[model samples]
Target: MGEGVTVSGDIAASSDIRIDMWSKLGSRVEVGGNAYLGEFVTIDGKLLVEGDLDVGKEVKIRGGFEAKGWIVVRNPVPVIIFLFLYIREMMRLGKGEEIEKAVEELFEDSEDSQDFEGKEPSENIMIIPAGAKISPEVIEVAGEADIGSNCLLIGNIRAQTVETGKNLTLKGSVYSEGKIIIGESSTVHGNLFSKGQVHIGRNSRIFGGIKADSVLMHENARVDGTIKAPSGVSFLREAAEKQILVEVNALGKGIVSKARELPKGVLQDDLIKAPDVAEIVSLIKSSAKAKNGFVPGRKRKTARTQALERTRRFTGARTYRKEKSGD
Candidate 1:
């Protein structure tokens, strides 16, 4: 799904589900395999994941969540970098031809796909603009969120990182899993909290207390309630606060605009490390996970269930899946 798209009901995917930024799901989400959620995505109801779950920052799954596999939250690497790493690894394993074939499958049209020659993916996609309000309710994001100067907002803000532009007005609390920067001359009616650090800007006023790992405030800033910072609190001059704000603004813009993919390639004379022959042999001998009628999420006792299996031709191994009920 694209950004700003809102789904009113539950979504059940047989395989993976990839959501773009700022999408909202009103109900439960059940993924049969892995799920990759973009920044600021919200699932209003329960989320069940069978395989791994990788999510960007500022994501909110308000109701609850259950993962049969791993739950990792981080920004994903770019497609180009991923492809490069994959090709390199396959080459080391003497399987370069397999990667080439996969690339061909993606770019080349086949006779089986001729009927879909002219169709666009618009029918299967939705796009929501960033910074657009689709609902009157509070917005929760999984990535860093920035509120511009002189803006007024209601309800609490939840994000991985947060920055409020100068002269902003907000009625709700700001919660950040990372750092938070409250802009100059802004007013917040609610508390400000962060897991990392907080910097309150010049002439800003906060009605509620502030809690964070560390706190930095301008000398002119005022907080009506108590301040709690385990690391300590420090005050900066107005110019210093302004400098910090400028730097933070620049960094935030860079992170959003740049393609900063992770796991950078380590080059030693433009050569990667070669795989060990022993390691490859060991990998081939490793046992595979047993396949059963296991599926992610709660199984429906009301529905009839059947186990379907097929034996592998060469290895004599079997694969199994749960048959749909009443089919």
Candidate 2:
């Protein structure tokens, strides 16, 4: 029936015991015929079925299950399973179905095996061993990434979170949507972009520009290009004659701009430049076009409508002034 049942002892039914919608059984449940479970059902003990077993949404079994007939589950698949399916579908779409079939066959046996045996291993974390050389164009890791000390990773790294050991060298850029930690004496030859916080270790060097939500730089860390952060930047200890271009919208607790003269002894560089008005205007026009989905001839019509509105408002103001004078 469509009700909850709590059983202290084992129930051995001759025909069938159907546990339906929002029903929960406390102890062991055994069915001789077909067993049907609906949404949000929890079985604390063992569940055994001789004929068939069917499960609906959010069914939890704490112990074990043994079914002689068929077992059917109807619920949204897990997120991990969806990701695998999405990747397979994309591969099938990009490459031919034959290639997809071949790839499936290559790893078909891995579906049952618990361990990684002759299967392409998927890992969340990839650790580059020390003194190892990797020359891939892009290394994608699902989870945290650790680059061993003295290792050379010669490509772009896209990861959730990245940590580099001391003396590590990267030839390409690093793009992390999460926090990125640069180890001491590490060198990155390309640009670094992070949506989350960035920590630059002492004596580390970045030859390219950096864009992040927030940046923390240790003393003596050299950045050759500009550093831009929306939240702000902080220095652990000031280095002597540190020459780096920082877009200082806010410095420390006080706000300082490139327009005003910087404090005489705090910073050593005069890296302020006026904004390019022409370039700024061009960027604004391009942004407006993209936002409005403007076509060539339609743009002129919109502009004419805006101009006519302005003219009508001006003429109306003048006529209102004339009537007030006449009154």
Candidate lDDT scores, in order, read 0.73, 0.72
Record all residue pairs in model 2 with backbone atoms less than 3 Å apart, i.e. clashing: none
Candidate 2 segments whose C-alpha is farther than 4 A from its true place: 1-135, 238-327
Give each model's clash number. Answer: 10, 0
Total colliding residue pairs, candidate 1: 10
TM-score computed on alpha carbons, candidate 2: 0.34
Residue-wise C-alpha lDDT for candidate 1, range 40-82, written one tens digit per residue: 8999999999999999989999998998888898855586688
- Candidate 2 C-alpha lDDT tens digits along 1-327: 344533334456654566665555567878777787877778888998999898988898887889999999987458458757766787768866766676687559643354333433332113232222222577666567777677776778877888888898999999899999999999999988999989999999999999999999997899999999999999888544543333433222323355654566755435444343231122223343555545444444577888999999999999999999999
Model 2 vs truth, CA RMSD: 26.1
